[model samples]
Target: MTNTHQRPLRILLAKLGMDTHTVGITIIAHALREAGMEVIFTGLKQTPEMVAAAAIQEDVDVVGISTLSAGHTRNLPKLARLLREAGAGDKLLLAGGVIPEEDRPLLEEAGVDRTFTMGSDTRDIVAYLNEWWAQQLAADA
Candidate 1:
């Protein structure tokens, strides 16, 4: 959180499935970078497997999914499973977009570290990442 590691938090963002509405995703990516984190946008129409593989291959600190469709209800858990299968389950799994409040609990149960739904502020998200990262560092220590 204090930039003690020299390298910024590496984040990989992806949109799984055929939905190509990337406006929200791109905004998040830019906001995160502006907040001093390294971001990797994996683009639209990516499969869950590709997202997971890229996350592991890129050695990212977090894997973020941007969803605007109902597919997340099914795809999110699958991505979590794939990450777990690839031994990267412990890494942070973040998602944000137009997800419904009714589905948030399900996402958490499916292994999502956090979900920033509609109306969530970028400042709050940035603060959360700072706090969360600090906690991780302390826990490791």
Candidate 2:
């Protein structure tokens, strides 16, 4: 379901690498859509290049990645670098799903604007995007 808004925030959701976790990303995508944001979900097994390309092509405001595999250590940084290299460093880079608490700092350092774990609520995610997008709009003004 798509929502009509003056300027609906656009987010792209991607499932990276061998991480086959679908339920979480699916639920999150639905939540974002329900919150009145436009979302483009890239199906599973996407490489960093693919994710970056999709985001650029879609002209999204945010890129949400979900990775459950241990490959996150390598994948996250590469994804960040690619996005940044493409001049998308200002775009909100969000990550979620099965990431360890210990690695949260590393992920943040690697360019993730926010990280959501298992117990996180859908409202929180929406609220964050709302605030971020609002700030961006203000800045652009």
Per lDDT, the best of the predicted structures is 2
Residue runs of model 1 more than 4 Å from their true location after superposition: 1-6
The count of residue-pair clashes in candidate 2 stands at: 0
Model 1 / residue 133 / CA error / Å: 1.3
State each model's CA lDDT, in order: 0.86, 0.87
Q: lDDT tens string, model 1, 4-121?
A: 3545778898999997878888888888899999899897899999999999998888898988887899999999999999999988999888889899899999999899986788
TM-score of 2: 0.93
Where does candidate 2 clash, by residue pair? none
Give the per-residue lDDT of model 2 (tens digit) for 33-104: 999999899998999999999999988889999877778888989999999999988778998888899998
